[model samples]
Target: MARNRTRAPSSTTTTATKTQTVRINGARVKITTKAGKVTTKPALPLEWELQAAQVASLRRLPQYQRQFLLAGDMNASKRGPRAQAQAIATGMTSGEPDLRIYGEYGRLLMIENKVGQGRLSPAQKDRHAALQRLGYTVLVIRATTTTEAAEQAVTAVLEWLAQEKGKAA
Candidate 1:
């Protein structure tokens, strides 16, 4: 059982807004939230939702696959401390990507989706580097424009396809 711990707003923080701007990985990102919504600039939208739509659209394409698995790698939840600890003890490993698209020929694409000026945490950076070292295709993407995020995913898959074809030949 996780502990329900909510910190009261400090003097520097405002109560009107749900999020505060802060720099992470050289990118300005909104921190914390209210009403379950991010209060930030218009540069980036909700990332998870955008990733969902992009994955769905890609799934319909034959190039992606007739049927594929899109696994959402959720890192956090609204659970309390105890539950959070329990989760970590179970399978909630640090630095996992947001989405895992298992493609053909055992190819895997790990996408870390970010919205607004959001950036990766230290653990995320470490994970990304580790995955890259292990010969995995990892992408840290921010969904800003209409098709930028999806386009990135497409490009990654295309590159992977080419690499796989080369291996077969």
Candidate 2:
């Protein structure tokens, strides 16, 4: 029988720890690996975080309570394939703005919320254009953090309402 030769495993094996940043929920999250195990943590505020802040701030305003509305079938999209298809069939249009505010005299403002380097998708652009053509005002609000986004959105809404108020007066 031929002699079998097997090399022994190295005693000094190096386990390299790797780190990387990835985008999750529109937030930058850091992922680290150690000894073949992985860990992830958010490095920035998520888009939903900003949106929730905006919603909370807007809801606090008495005037906003009645006029503010959250649009889009985002929940349906998250539910699964059947729900998405059903939503589409039931007139859930794509690229709808995340929020809408109805002002006096039938004026409207649509808000597209974004975080970080987010930009309008092609479908969003088209939908916004259509709304504009129908005499609606659309605003794209973007910020890196939740605090900034809420403040910016509130300020913009108040200013627009002020302008509308001025026009009426």
Candidate 3:
């Protein structure tokens, strides 16, 4: 019979170790690492960061104005002849007018608003023509609500439109 032989097992056991490190401007930063995971703290609050970005964007525009226009079923038809004529003949494809006025004789008036400092560019004139072609008299009003300036621009536009309509009639 042959003598039995036995071998002793090694005492080492396999285990996973995780290492964590942080960096700041090319220098190693202190970071707590555990279970092979790492995370960094945010430097600024999200809300504050977003507000700062928005303010920066708004500052780029020197003048800002909002235009309101008449709302009608005809305005809703994007493919209609009136809409096409307005866009092709007068450049006002967008159906928004600054204000809409109804006259005693069933006439309609459209107003476009702009800031007082805003100049009437060629593009703006084109838009005005577009609104006129749609049979809605167009006018541009300065941006102000003070007593001296309040509503004067709109009044002037109305008078002009009335005169034009009278001439046409």
Candidate 4:
């Protein structure tokens, strides 16, 4: 009689689809795997993400490196009610734009960053209208992704700079 023999399992490929979620740069992204292939894309970027990207891109330009300011308190609502009340008590105005760029001849351009179905609040609308009335340019950029937001911000800034240059001539 022969002793029982055992055989090792053969290597095989599986094609069932799989998915995973991961955090990248503070954003949750979804990755898909099917038939040994993987695909991934970042989730819709948050307002802060868009703002950060815009600032980073703008600062890359020498002319704008020192001429821009970011109003980071726009998201104060997330800081809890006490902090929010304190901020308001300290003269933190509502509806402030995210970015302020000082151009030639003291001209001002304000940009409000938004992503994925975002809209300005009533306070923001009022503030923007008041700013526009004061001869300040206010732009609202709504994009689907961070890169697009940054590109739009850069393009708007470059156009504003060019227009200012033209007026100076």
Candidate 5:
């Protein structure tokens, strides 16, 4: 009789276990999959919450404003209101705010513009408070304004700055 030459069946499975990981606020987090089972690691520091809030606020901006805000070139004079908005910022940073209006005398004013359903996040409130502590006046405005409202807001901000300038002088 011919000897049986068939190989023994393999014990190991060919399917691979996959994993994904992200670090938030300096803490390591991991996600793993095994046999189609998925799991997530624990949350990191509260900094992630703050970052998420900032990102959420950024997402609220119009696409063009968002682009200019990220590019840090909104302060450059261009064509229309968007260009004028960019031109107002003296120092802009994605980590902080949409615009940083600087007075002629060097005082800083951080402005957050909202188009509709104006709401301020905890992180934004914290930032505004911090700016106030640093002697910078912070203002929040609804961007969907008539030309008159826009003019009034600008005048109010400039007038406040003038008073601040007078005090410093």
Candidate 6:
């Protein structure tokens, strides 16, 4: 005769109570709390963060001026059938790049800024292709899953602009 042997379960279980302490900098009153399970969302949207940085960089350079950014398909809370109809009536479009700059001497730049898990949507891809065919300069900037990548993308674009300036001169 053979008998089966079983071992007892360990003390650790998924239901076990766990807590983490996080300190927020620059807060006047830092209160600590503990809970069984904790969930979190991002402090800011990565795509927007990256785009703002790029826009700020462009602002610092004198050659970049009178830029226009497309904002269709953003702000879902403000989007509905009526709002969409108004957009179409006003000649607004979808999948347009997030950034556009009118540079000195007829030079123009168009950029789609993406960070972390962001990617160009189908409409954006088609817009980019159409813009390219029309001899417009279009660029897509993607960053790895980190803040440094976002910063690097901005720096690289600024550097490219500087190089293009040199070529024109």
Task: Identify the leading candidate in terms of lDDT.
Answer: 4
Q: Which stretches of candidate 6 lie over 4 Å from their true place?
A: 1-44, 62-78, 144-150
lDDT of 4 by residue, 1-169 (tens): 9999998886986789999879978779989999989999876777888888888888888776464444444643577889988888998778878888777778888988777778898989998899898888899999888889999999998888889889989
Of 2 and 3, the candidate ahead on TM-score is 2
By TM-score, who's the top model here? 2
Please identify model 2 stretches exceeding 4 Å from their true place: 1-29, 32-42, 66-77
lDDT, model 1: 0.73
Each model's lDDT comes to: 0.73, 0.79, 0.47, 0.81, 0.52, 0.59
Give one digit per residue, the lDDT tens place, for model 1 in 1-169: 9999999877674455455667667665767566466555433446666687667666766765443466776684468899898988998878899888786677787888786468788998998899999998887777675377777777766676677678767
Badly placed stretches (over 4 Å) of model 3 are 1-95, 119-127, 143-145, 157-169
Candidate 5, 1-169: lDDT as tens digits: 9998998899986557887667768665667788778877753323223323433444454432422232112221245877555644744433254555444545565656544455676766776777788877666655433333345345545566557668777
How well is each residue in 1-169 modelled by candidate 6, as lDDT tens digits?
8899798997775564444334346322323233444554233335665666655655565544432222212422256899879977986666777666555556557767676557788888898899889888877777643355446645655675676678778
Writing each residue's lDDT as its tens digit, candidate 3 over 1-169 gives 9989887886864344444445578554445445555655422222222223323332333321211122322222347777688665864444354445444345666545444455655665776677687776776555432322334533453465456568667
Better of 1 and 5 by TM-score: 1
Q: How accurate is candidate 4 locally (lDDT)?
A: 0.81
Structural similarity to truth (TM-score) of each candidate: 0.64, 0.72, 0.32, 0.70, 0.39, 0.58
In model 3, the Cα lDDT at residue 95 comes to 39
Scored against the true structure, residue 134 in model 6 reaches a CA lDDT of 89
Q: Which ten residues in a row have the lowest lDDT in candidate 1?
A: 35-44
Instruction: List the lowest-lDDT window of 10 residues for candidate 4.
Output: 67-76
Candidates 4 and 5 compared: the better one by lDDT is 4
Which of the two, 2 or 4, has more lDDT?
Answer: 4
**Model 6 worst lDDT run, 10 consecutive residues:** 68-77
- Residue pairs of candidate 3 with colliding backbone atoms: 68-97, 68-98, 69-97, 90-130
